[model samples]
Target chain A: MDGVMNPTTNIISFDLTTTSLRDVNHYLHHQVSPGNHIDIHHPNGAHNLAVGLQEAIAVDIHGHTGYYAAGMNQLASVTIHGNAGAGVAENMMSGRVHVKGFASVSAGASAQGGLLVIDGDAGLRCGISLKGGDIVVGGSVGSFSAFMAQAGHMVICGDAGDALGDSLYEAVLYVRGNIKSLGADAQIEPMTEDDQAIVANLLEQAGFSHNPNDFQRVASARQLYHWNADAKQDY
Target chain B: MCGIVGLLIKNPALRDSLGALTVPMLIGMAERGPDSAGLAVFTQPIAESDRKYSLYSGTTVVDWGQLIQALHQQLGGTAQIHTQGNHGILTANLSPAVVKPWIHEHYPAVHILSTGRTIDLYKDEGQPAAVAERYGFSQLKGTHVVAHTRMATESAVTPAHAHPFTAGEDFCLVHNGSLSNPHSIRRMLEPRGIHFDTDNDTEAACRYLEWRMQEGDDLKSALQKGFEELDGFFTFLMGTQDTLALVRDAFACKPAIVAETDDYVAIASEFRSLAHLPDIDHATLYEPAPEEMYVWTVS
Candidate 1:
C-alpha cells in the first residue's frame, strides 16, 4: 500500500480501517491542497479525525466517526459515510462537513461558517451559537440546538429537540418534524415566499427528497425584547 | 469562539455621542466572545489637509496615556481617553499621523490595526469584563461602537487576535464563520500587499472586503460580492465609518435574527440579548436570508 500511495497528487484514497486517525489528519493538514478530491473506504469510528483544516479538499469517510470528529474546520468537503460523535464540526468556519449517519451532541456548536449536513438524527445543540453557517439535519436534532445563534439557518427533517431555537436572534430555524415545544421567545410564523424558496433549495441540497411546502417555519416571537410590566403579568 | 456586539445609528442625535450605549452593548454579550474586547468610534470625515499637521503621522499606535497627556497639555483641559481592552479612543486635539510614528517607534509590536480621523481602536486579551474593567470602557461615550469576545479555535488568543478587525482605513469586520478557501484567497491577496495578523477565517473575510472596496465598490456592493465570491457558511457583520451590513452564505448555515420597529433595530445571537430593550412589542423578528445581505447606513 505504501509503494502505491502518492502524496502530491490531487486525487487521494483512504482505506479507513488500515489508516491511523493521526495519519488522516496529518495528510489532510499537510498533504492535500485546495480543490483536491479524496475518497475513503472502511472508516469505523475514527476519533478527532479531521480538525482545523483550511483547504478545499474532499474526503469521504466510509463509516462513523468518534468524538469531535471534524471540529473547527475551515475549508474542506468531508462526507462521512456513517454516523458521527459529539461536537461534530464544532466551531467550523467554512466549507462543507457532511455526515451520512446519526450525530452525537453539540453538532456544529458555535460554528462561525460552513455547512454541516447530518443525514440522520443529531444530538443536542446542533448549530448552537452558530454565527454563520447552514446546518441541514436530514433527521431529528436533540435539544437546545441553535440556542443563541447570531446568524445562520438550521433545517431539520425529522423531530426536533426541546427548545429548538430558543432566544434565537438573527438566525432562521426551519423544521419539517414534530416539535414538542418551542423554547423561550420562539414562535411559529408563516413561511414567506422567499422563505419557501430557500427551504426548497435547502431541502434539495440536503437530499431530503421531501416537499418544502410541508415544512413549517419557526422564529423568535420578539416578545421578550418588549417585555413590560403588563407583559410580565401575562407571563 | 468569540462574542461580538456592534451598534450603528443613523440619527444625527446618535452620532459621535454613542459611547455610552456602546460600552454596555459590548459588555452585554461578553460571554459569547470572552477572550478579548475592543471599541472604535468615528466622527464625521476630516479634511485630508488638516490631518497633515496632526501629531500622529500615518496609522500607528501611540503610548495612549502619554499621547492623551500631550493632547491635554496642548488643548489645556482634561482630555477624555476611553480604553477598552488593548484598544482605546481618545477625544482630543492631536494629529493621528504624528501619534502614529511615535507609537511605531516606542511600541513597535503594538500594531495600529487601523487609523482614520474618526476611528480609533483598543483591544487586549482576557474576558470582556476584565478588558472592560482594565480599559475603563464603562465611561466611554460614542454614537456607535462594536466589541467582541473570543474563544480561539483556528487562531491564537491574543489582543491582536480580537474582533472588530479593520481591513482598511474605515472598514472593519466581525465574523462568525470560517472561510474554507483561506489559503488560496490568502495567496491571492497577500501578493497584492494585503496583510494578515491572524489565521482566522474572518481575516480572509476582512481582506476580501478590503479588496472589493478598493476596487471602487461601496460597502453594500462589496458585501454582495462577498456573498457571491466567498464560500462556506458565514454570517458576517461589517461596519464602515457610516454603515453596518450583515451577510449570510448561500446555504444559510449560521444563525442570525433581526428585530425591527419604528424606533429601534436590534440584532443578536439570541432574542434575550435584546430583551431589555423597550418597545419590542410584537416586533417583526426575522432572520436574514441565506446568500442575502441586510445593510443599514447612517447617512
Candidate 2:
C-alpha cells in the first residue's frame, strides 16, 4: 500500500478509499516492524481489515469495521474508533483489540489469549466459547454471552442480559452491575480478595475507574460436568 | 443469509430522499443476497374510501390499460392504474373483498404484491442492484420503507418468494433468517380462511402477525405472540401505515443494527449498509436486543 508518511510521529496512514484492503493487509502481514504505528482511514464497515497481524505494531482504524475486523490478531494492538461488526476478534492469539463504539455479536469469540475492550455495549454471545482470552466491556452484554466458555476472564462494568455465563468451564466473570439471569450450571459465588485483585488489574488495563469490590463473580457450579440419568434431559 | 433494510423518515423534509438513501443500503448487502430483491414504500394515505394494490405481471406483458378498464367495467368502480414495466399499482374505491378475487379469476397470471391505503410494493428476480435500478427505487418518496434481498434457503428463488411479504393492508415484513415451523404455521392459518400466497417461510410470519392484528391485537402484543409461536432464527423488520417495528428471535442469532437521528431511523442487517447514511457519524447506533419489540412511529 502507498501510505503517506506522518513526518512528525513517524506514523503511516493508509486511506482505504484509495488503497485496496488486500494491499494494506499484505503490507501489515509481511512488512511491518515491531515498533511501527499505522493509521487506517475510511474503514467504513469493511470486513477483515488488518486481520492476522503477527507484529507488535499499533493500528488505529479511524471508522467502523465489519465482520472479523481483527480476527486471529497477534502481537499488534488494534483499535477501532467506531463500531465493530460481528466476530470482531474471533480466535485472536494475542495483543489487544479495543472498540470505541458498540460491537456486534460474538466479540472476541473463542479467542485464545488477548485483551478485547469495548468502551460501549457488546451484542449477544460475546466471548462465546472463549479459550483463555480476557474481555472487558464498559457497557452491557446481551443474552447467552460467555456460553460454554472454557478458560478466561470477562469483566462487565455494566449490566448483562439473559444467561450471563452458561455451562462455563473454568471461566470467571466479574460484573459490577446487575445480571438478568445466569445460564445452566452457572452461579454467583461470593467474591474473594483474589477475585478483587484480578478485577482491579483488568479494570486498570481497560482504563476504567470502577471499584473492584463492587463486582460479583459468576462461575460454574460443576453440576453438569457429568451425566445424571434420574434428572431427565432438562437442565 | 438474506438482507433486510428499513428506513422511516421522521422529518418531512427528508422523506423525499427515502429511496435514494436506501438504495446503497440494499446494494451493500449484495453479497448476502443476490437472487431477488423487493421493497414496500408507504406514502401519504389516499382517501379513506380508496385502496391500492401492487400488481406484478412477472415476465409477461399485459395491457394495464385494458385491465384497469375491465376492472372499472365489471367491478363498476373508477379504477386508475400507474405502470412501470410489467408492474402496476391500481387504485380504486373498491374493497379488497370484491377486487382481489375478481383479478384472480380474470388475470390468473398476475401476482398481487401488496394492498393498502398507503403502501405500494415492487419485487423481481434479479440482482439487488439491477432490481433496484429496474424499478426506479431511487425516485420513490415515502414516510417509511421495508425492503429485502433474498438468498432463497427455504423456498424457490421467485419474485413472489422474495420478501416484503404482506398479508393485510399497509403492512409488510422482511426476514433475514429461516423459520423452522413455517409449515405448521401455515396449517394453523389455513383453517381460518387465510390464503397462502407462497410456501416461503417469511410469508408465514407476515400472515401470522397480520392475522394477530386482525384479531384485535396491537403490534406489540402481536409480536409478543409471535415470539412465543414462531420457532426459528429470524430478524424481522416490518412496516405498517405509520410505524416500523423490528425484532430478533430469542437466541438472537441473526444480526441487525439501527442508526437513528432526529431526521430518520435506519435499520439494516449490518452496519455496512448504514455507513453511507446522512449524519450517520452522529446517529445513535445500537443493536436491537433479542426478543424485544422496537417500534417507531411517525409523528
Candidate 3:
C-alpha cells in the first residue's frame, strides 16, 4: 500500500485466486526489485508459496499456506497472516519468517540459519534435524519435536507433546510448559542465567508474553555419539 | 505419495456449491500426486427403491447406450443414464445386488466403479485439474464429496486403479499411503470368499473394511478394527450414504489436516487444499491424532 516515489520501496502484488503458483513463484524468484515489499493475496492454503527467496525484501501473504511455505528462505522476511501447512520454513537461511497462525508438521526441519516464529501451535516434529536456526513458538508443539536437532536454539512457550526431543544433538531446547515425554538421549538440564536471558530475548522478539525464566533446557546426553566398549552392558 | 480430500457440508445452503468448492481443493493437491485423479460426489438420494451406479470403461470411449438398454431389459427396471467423458453414471430402480451380478455375467469388460443411492464416482489417469474438468465437477450438485490423486505406487497407472475404491453400497474410500501386508491380507480374504477387482493395496484395505462392516460394524468400529488388523502407513478418507470418515495410522507418517466450520467439515492431506474453503480462516483447524478416527454424519 505504500508504493510512493521512493524508488527503492516498490510494491508488487500477486493474487493467487486469479494466478497460478508457478506464476507467483516465478515473479518472486526473478521479477522483484531489491528491498521491495511484495503483497500476496488469497493464498488460500496453496503449498510451496514464496519458497527459495534470496532477497532482502519483505513479503506479506494474506491467507493460509500449504506445505513448505517460505522454504529455503534466504535474506528475506516472509509473514503469513494465516495458518501454515507442513514444513513451514524448512531449510531457511537468513532473515526471518513469521506465521501468525498454527503450523503443521516439521515446521522448520533441517534449517541451517534464519529465524522462524509461530504465533500458534506447531504440529508434530516442530523442528526436526535442525542444522542451525532459531525457532520460537508462542504455543505448544506436537510429538517428536527437535528430533536429531544438530545446532541452534528452539523455544516453546506452551506445552509439548510426547517425545519432545528424540536423539537430540547440540541444539538447545527451551520449553516453558510441561513435556509429555523426553526422547532417547534427551534430558533436561539446569538452565543458567545466560540461557534465561537468551530465551527472554527470543520470546520478546517473537512477541510472546511469557516469562522466559520459567523455561527448561533439554539437550543431548552425548552418550551415543561414539561407541564405548565399557558402555555395552548398558545397551 | 498421494493426495486425499473429503468435504461434508452440514449447512444446506452450501449444497449447490459443493462441486465449485471441491474443485479448487482437489486441484491444490496437484503436487502430491499427479498420476491419476478421481472424485465421488454424494447428492440427495432419490426414492428408496432407486439405486445409482457409476461405471468406468478402461477404454477411452465406449457406446454405453446399448449396455444401459440391455441392463434395463435384463433387470426389467427403469434406468436413466448420463455419460461424461469415458465415465457413465446409471441410476436405476434395481437393487445393486441384482444389477451387479447381471452386469458381471453379461459384460465382463465394464468396470462398476461404485453403486449407491446417492453417490456418483468419476476418475481417470491425468492431472488433477484436467480430471476434475472432464467430470464437470464444478457443476455437480452434492452435499458431500471425496476425491483422490494417485501417484501409482501399489498398482499400474490405469483408470481402473484410480482411487475412491468402492467398498460396498453407498461406500467408497481413498488412500494416501501403502499397505505393507496386502498380499497376505488378500490371501486371508480370498478363502473367506471376498473378491477384489484391482491389485492396488488400497482396494485390499477397502475390501477389508467392507468385510468388517458387513459383519455389522459401524464405520468408526470398522476403522478401529482396521488399526489393529492392517499394517502399514495409511491415511484413509471414507464416505458412506450419510457419513464422511477419516483415519490415520499410529505412526502418523502420512500428513492430514482437518478444518471445521459451521458450514462444513473438511479433511485433506494438507492445509493448502482447505485454504480456499469458505470462512476457513475462522474455522478451527488441527491435525488428527495418530490411530484416531473422525466421523461426521448428516442429521
Q: TM-score per candidate, in order?
A: 0.51, 0.98, 0.90
Q: Interface Cα RMSD for all candidates?
A: 15.0, 0.9, 1.7
Ranking by lDDT: 2, 3, 1
Recovered share of real interface contacts in candidate 1: 0.00
RMSD of each: 19.8, 1.3, 3.2
Tell me, by TM-score, which candidate is best.
Answer: 2
Leading candidate by lDDT: 2
Query: What does candidate 2's lDDT look like per residue over B1-299, in tens digits?
Result: 99999999989998889999989999998888999999999999999999999999998899999999899889897899999989999999999999999999999999999999999999999999999999999999999999988899988998889888998899999999999999999999999999988989999999999999999999999999999999999999999999999999988888899999999999999888999898998999888988889999988
Q: What are the runs in model 3 whose C-alpha is more than 4 Å off?
A: A1-36, A228-235, B60-65, B72-80
lDDT of 1 at A45: 41
Off by over 4 Å in 2: none
Predicted candidate 1, C-alpha RMSD: 19.8
How many residue pairs clash per model? 67, 0, 1
Off by over 4 Å in 1: A1-235, B10-17, B46-102
Q: Which scores better on DockQ, 1 or 3?
A: 3
Give the CAPRI class of candidate 2: high
- Listed per prediction, chain B TM-scores read 0.79, 0.99, 0.96
What TM-score does candidate 1 reach? Answer: 0.51
Q: For each model in turn, which proportion of the native inter-chain contacts is also found?
A: 0.00, 0.76, 0.71
Top DockQ model: 2
